[model samples]
Target: MKAFRLEELEAQRAANQGAYLQFLRERNMSVGLYALDAGQADPQQPHGQDEVYFVVSGRASVTVGDETETVARGSVVYVPAGVVHRFHHITEDLKVLVVFSPPES
Candidate 1:
């Protein structure tokens, strides 16, 4: 079993681009913590594997292809493999738990 604390991970914001702390990695899947400050843009591209985003705190507008939705704490969003998606109009500091299947490379 593995354990993680968000507060500890948040303190490791070593870059202005937000903090991406990967905590769990297995043969079939991986999990990570992503924290982005308000007004910051997400610099991510489409992934080769399916992914799920579990919002741990804060709020944001997430765009998956042509559809956009407001997400907050406890919200879960899914993006299929190779889909275009991004977070914008961040109204609050966004802290999310990211899960990727097939273990992203």
Candidate 2:
């Protein structure tokens, strides 16, 4: 089993963008915890793999295609392959559980 402390992961943010914490990665999937600070939005791009997002803490507004939804703790969102989606308005340091099938990276 592998374990990663949140504090340790938080210290390794991707230098090119907003902060992120990757906890695990394997051949077919990737799992991680992410934090989106208030007013932050990652670039939107279409991916060839399925993506699932579960709001672990705080709140966020997610846009998928022409639809947008407010997701908070316990809320879940799915993005199928090729869907154009992005996250935003991450108030209060939103924490999210992210899973990607056929891991992009």
Candidate 3:
């Protein structure tokens, strides 16, 4: 079994000066943490693998293709491969747990 501590990971993230901190990876799946401050832009593009985002904290809205929806703590979202999506108009800092299937290449 593997255990990961959020605070520890966050500290590592800060030390690395990166926006994403991947904690686990396997053949079929991978997990990472993505942090964005309020009013910051999400610098991401459409991925080739399916993705699931779980909002650990904060407030924002995500636009998947043409549809947009509000998200906050406890919000779960799914996006299929090759779909354009991004979080915008962040009213609060966001910490999102991201899961990628087929282990994003």
Query: What is candidate 3's CA lDDT for residue 47?
Result: 96
Candidate 1 per-residue C-alpha lDDT over 2-104 given as tens digits, one digit per residue, 9 for 90 to 100: 7777776666644434468777899999988888789999998999999999999999999998999999999999999999999999999999999999888
Model 3, range 27-67, lDDT digits (tens) per residue?
99999999999999999999999999999999999999999
Candidate 1 Cα misplacement greater than 4 A, ranges: 13-18
Q: Which of candidates 1 and 3 reaches a greater TM-score?
A: 3
Compare candidates 1 and 3 on lDDT and give the better one: 3
Off by over 4 Å in 2: 4-8, 11-18
Across 1-105, the per-residue lDDT of candidate 2 in tens digits comes to 888765566666545355556678899998877777777777658878898998877887899887999999999999998998988877767877788898767
lDDT (Cα) of model 2: 0.79
Residue pairs whose backbone atoms clash in candidate 3: none
Candidates ranked by lDDT, best first? 3, 1, 2
